[model samples]
Structures are given as C-alpha cells and as structure tokens.
Target: MASVSSSRSSPIGKLPVDVFDSILSILNEEDRDTLKNCSSVTKQWHDRCVRIIFSSLDINNKNTNAFPAFQTWLSINVDAAAVVKTLRIWKLPVEIDVDQLASVLAPLAGLQNLTLQFIREPQSQIKSSSPLSIQGPRSRSLNTLELLLPSEANRSMLAALTVICLFDTINTVGMQGFSSLKPDLRSTEGLTKVHQLRLQYLPQACASEEMNMFSGIMTSAHLRSLYLECHSPSSWDGLRILSQTFVNLKFVDLDLVQLKNCVKDVDWTTLWKALSSCAQLQRLRINPPSLVDALVTAPSKLFQTSLTSGGCWEVLRELVIGPGYSPRAESLPNRIQRMLWDLPGIVRHDLRGPFPNLDTVTVEVPLSAPMQKRDENGRSNGLAAPTVVSSEQVKSAIVRALPSLQEEGLLRITVIGRT
Candidate 1:
C-alpha cells in the first residue's frame, strides 16, 4: 500500500513531452492551483504549467485580496507577465491609485484583450497613460476592449475612456451604463476604424445627448455595426441621428425597454422615418410594439402615398421582431401581412428593382395554453384545450400573403412561440 501510494504521486516529469503539453493545454485558469503544483514537480513541467496559468489574468475583489496577491506574485516573478494575453480588471478598490494600476499593467507587452470596470466614487485628475505599454512606432496588437460603468458619466470615467482609446489596435469596443457622452471622446484618433460599437443601458434623459456624442465620435464611413439598448421614447431621436450619421452602417439592433413614464402604445413613426435614410442597411432588429403600433394607428393609404414618394428600404436583408406583448387589435396577422408586403415601397420608390434584399424574418411570440387530448369513456380524460394560434399558423399566413416567397424559396421564416 505504501509503494502504491508513492507511485500514484510520481513526478509529472515522467510523462512524455507531448502528453505533458496536451495535459497543460486542456486546463484553464480555473486549474491554476493544480498547474502550480505540477510546475513544482520539475523544471520542464514548470515552463509548460506556468505559461498556461498566467495566459489570462482576472483581477477583481470578489475573491478577497486577489488583486494585491497577484501584484505581489507578479513582482516576484516578473517574467510571467509577458505570458498574459487577456486582462480583466473589474470592481477595483477606490483606495488603489491609478499609478499602481498602471505599473501592474505595464509589464503585459503581449496583452491582446482588456476589460476595465471602475465602480467606486470618481476621483479627479488621475493622469492615466495608455494602458498598453508598447514602445516604438509599432501599432498595438490588442483587438477588443470593453468598458462598463454605472448610469452616471463623470469626468473621471470620460478620462478613462480617453486613456483606453489612445490604443490604436482596438477594432471593437463595447460600452455600457454611460449616461452621457463627452466631447473629448470624439478627439480619439484611434476610433477611425472602429467598425463595431455597442452602447447599452441608455436611460431616458440622456438618450439625445448620447446620440449627439456618438454621432460626433463615429465618422459615417468608419462604423458598420451599431447596437442600442434604450429605456425611453427619446430613443427615436437617437436612432434618427444614428441613421443619418452612419450612412454606411450595415447592421442595427434596437431594444426599447418600457420606462416608468412612457405610454403603453408607442409611436414608431419617428423610428421608421429615421430608418428611411439608411439605404445601405442590411440587417435590423426592432421591438415588436413599434411595428404593431404603426400598423394599428396609421392608415393603409399612408403606406401607398409613401411608396409613391420614393422612400423604400431597398437594401434590407434580415429582420427580427421581439418577444412581443399582446397587441390591442385582433387582426394582427392581416396588419402584419399588409405592412410586410408594402413596407419596402413605403420608404423608397424603386419600381424597376426588387425593392428589397430581404431573405430572413424572425418573430418571437408569446406561448399560449395548449388543448389537452381526451381518452375513451368520455369522463373528462383531460382532452379539453384552449384555442390558440400556433407559430406554424402564423408562418402559413405570411406565406399565403406573399405567394412569391413560397415559390422562390428565398425567404426563410422563423416563428418562435409556444411549441
């Protein structure tokens, strides 16, 4: 039993080099302690295990003293910092100085991804340098950056955004919870080619201001994808600005959350009117209530009149509607069919052309109670069920309305709901 126990704990160095590499490659940062134990077994194992352990670093307070401990470890073994490719610093302590954070990040020359979230009370005048410590004229290799803040936008947070944007390698950025956009964000030269931008958690009062800020920062030709998660009707003003500002935009996703003060019936005319300018738009996802409201309130001749005026969405290809609320009207299918058939011509007039590049439509509806099947003896064997419209029925209705879609097989309809 003693011999068996000793053999079971034999040195990791006994394994073949290929086998050792494979074992280390499969283990993530979660297995850091086990990897450290393996590294202590022998010199060869040390190189393999340490590289895997230090490849990505997450610094946060949730683990209790993890950031300080990592700083201490990094100070002792400075070479390990070069192995880091992804760094995440979230929920930092207010007591930690910006200089201290800078010094810790300076060693990561190979870092490619960085996410920073500072939630503590804001401090003024922290003179932060470029987070990446790359030297010489060579551009940074970092590709993605994510900045998350609370609903309030302070001078300190804007300064952080400025410091981060100094890096030329970032091609995509996702920012959330910023209540306003400062003009300083527009001076970022590195954002010229930032093709993808995500703006989330926009509040009602700040919607117009944020749109103005974004319009200033993003040049029309540079931005391609824009996503907005808004909490007010003021989103219409922002969307209008975005449509006119980013003419080359290919994708747009809009999520309008119902705010406490907003009306139950939203008017989508402003949003649709804004969309009229996006001639290059290929993909769009909008809240279902907007479309439902437009059809319910607007006259059918309004669409025909708009078609004659030459306002159409000719380049649109993909559309997605929401997990919707129940509409006020019962003839939803007919209204939807009428809008789908005539929407292309409503925004633009292109009689010689196909009018739309549309290929796919996705609708997410609420599930309804299903009817139960009964058995013999007619003693109420759970056969009664509520009458409900199925997704298939909706699909069939759409196909019937547009028979050309059925013949061409170019249109793909996805209806998601109860079974």
Candidate 2:
C-alpha cells in the first residue's frame, strides 16, 4: 500500500514557484473561490493564492451574516487589504460604522478601482461631517470609480461620497440613475481631471437648476469619452454643454429612448445638431429609442437634410445606429427591405462632405421584432415568441447598403438579441 501511494503521488504542489504563479495568474475571476480553498493546502500556495483571492472584493449589505466576518478578516489580516485592487460596495450597511469600514480599508493603498452602488434612502440626513466623510489612506490610488444612485438618493450624500478619500485620484467616472448631482462637485479636485464620463438613466423633464449642475460637471471635466443614456427624448439637456465643451472629446455614445407618444421631428433635428457641433469627435453611436408606430415614415430625407446642413463630422471615423425597434404598418420582412433600400440612399445624400477620416457605418438591428408570429392558417401562434425578422435578411439589407456608403469596407451590420 505504501509503495502504491508513493508511485501515485502528485507533483502539482511541489512545482516551481513560477510555474504555480503562472497557473494562478491564468485563472479567471470565477475560479477565485476555488483558489481560496487551495490557499490553505500549503504555506507556499497560501501567499500567492490569498493575494489573488483578495485582489477583488465584492461586499454587499444584503449578505448581512457574512459581512461582519469579512470586516473582522480585514481587521486581522491587514496585509490582505493591501492586495485589493478593486472594491465594490453594493449598499452601505446602517449597522456598521462608516469610519470602521474606512479603517479596514485604510491600508489598501494599492486599490485602483472602486464602485459604490447605493440607492436606499438614508435613514437620516448625512451631515457634511459625518463619519462616512472620513478619508482613508488608500483613496489616493483609486483612479476609476463608478457611482450608482437611486432616483431618491440624497444629492448631498452623492457629493459627500465623491469628496471622500476617493476625490484625489479618480479620473474615469461612471454615474447611473442620477439626473444631477450637487453643483459643488464640479469644484472638487478629482472631477476636474476626469477624462471618461458615462451617465445613464437620466430623468425626463430636468429642472433648470439640475441641468445647470449636470452641465457644470461635464464642462469642468476635460472629458475624452462621453456616453449618455436617457429615459426620455426630452431629457438630453447636457447635449448643449457637450457641443460647447469637451473640446478634447473623442468618443460619444447617445442611447436616447422616447415613449410611444414622444417621437417628433424636432428631437431628431436636435440630436443631429448636437452631433454636428462635436468637431473633435471620432466615434459616434446613436441608438434611437423604439418608436411604436405602424410606419415610421422613413425619415431618410429629414436625416439627409439635417446632416448636410449641420457641419461635417470632421474626424468622425465610425457611426452606429440602432439595435432599434421601429414597428411599421407593413410586415416584418417588408419593413426590413425598405430600411435596407432606404438607409443607403439617405447616407449617400446626407454624407456628401469630405469624410476624410470616415471609415465604417454600422446598422444594428434587434433580432426580436415587435410583431407576433403567424401559423400556416393565418392564426396567431401564441406558443412561439414574436419574430420581427430573420437575421439573414437583416445582414443582406446591410450588404445592399454597402455600395452606397462612401468607403468600401465602411458598412457593417450588427444584430443583437435580448440578453
């Protein structure tokens, strides 16, 4: 038995440190929990495996039972905190003192990314001098920060959190579900240096003060990439600010959605004007909201006229439209055919200027159609999901439009389905 066991022994644990290191390095984030168990097998494995395991921490207040233990671990294994490069806090726990949490994270000087997602209405107004305002040592290394706020979240809290230890080194900022933040945040030292800004879920009918505050934030930052997604067509108050500011802007993505009743010609014209004013923009993506109508009388002429009148997209290299849904009076196949035949003509007329840097124009079509499937007997097939159009026809439509495009390799089509 002893001889057999000796012959069957594994050499994985005894491998050279570099070999073991390479193996751990290749492991994906999902394998970290498994690697954590391996960390206990031997001292050599523990050092490397533990470091990798603690590199990213996801702390959610919903997991109430496990949080205290996590906090205690951070307190005891102070060195482990140093390895954490990414920290995500889903919701702050009311029971735990923010200062204590800050203390636990104080040693995380190497932290590079932080995400704070808080939507819960505060139990009480958080004072400017609240313990949560206490700065931690590692806040200086945090460069990329994502702030997710619920509509009801206090703007003061958003400003206070932004001003925390995180204010010093943050350069890239992503905000979701916040129509506007405190105007005072524009004066914060960190926001002025931001280069990439992404804002999503902007509320409809923004107040003048709120628009000013949001505009101030955008204008103050020397943004290179600005991505905005709005809940309604009328919510894009920041477009005016971008046209005048963000002189260094390179990439812009506007995902604008409108209610069935809100689609108007002025909206499209406003959008085109905004695009024209961005003289330095390189890549542009416009995902128009789904307009539920029997026929969205192909605004091809309007698009051509507006784009031609507005100045040329001087450095624009790539343009993408849709993953859009437009319900027409005709059948799915007919509508697809019309869009394919019409889009190229629109592009030919609209884009007559010197597109020296223009390269690709992408039409993104959604696989799911707005119509119901029909059976052979012309009855609604309730068992099957709705089919708008087939993927092949969509691709063919893009292929047909290619010849009309200014550049040969310029036309591309992308089809995205419900995730």
RMSD of each: 8.6, 8.5
Q: On residues 1-419, what C-alpha lDDT tens digit does candidate 2 reach at each position?
A: 00000112122332234434444566886554445366356766666665755677776565444455556555655666667888887665322345545554566778778776664545644434432244444335357888766665545334434333434445678876653444343343333356677776566644546555544444444668888876665555557545665666788887754434455533555666766777788998776555534224543343554545555777888877766555523355555543443355566654546345778887777664555677775566667776655677667756655566634667777778741
- Local accuracy by lDDT, each model: 0.56, 0.57
The clash number for model 2 is 3
Evaluate residue 112 in candidate 1 and report its C-alpha lDDT on the 0 to 100 scale: 76
**Reference-based TM-score of each model:** 0.67, 0.72
Candidate 2 residue pairs in clash (backbone atoms < 3 Å): 294-328, 294-329, 369-388
In candidate 2 the C-alpha lDDT for residue 47 amounts to 64
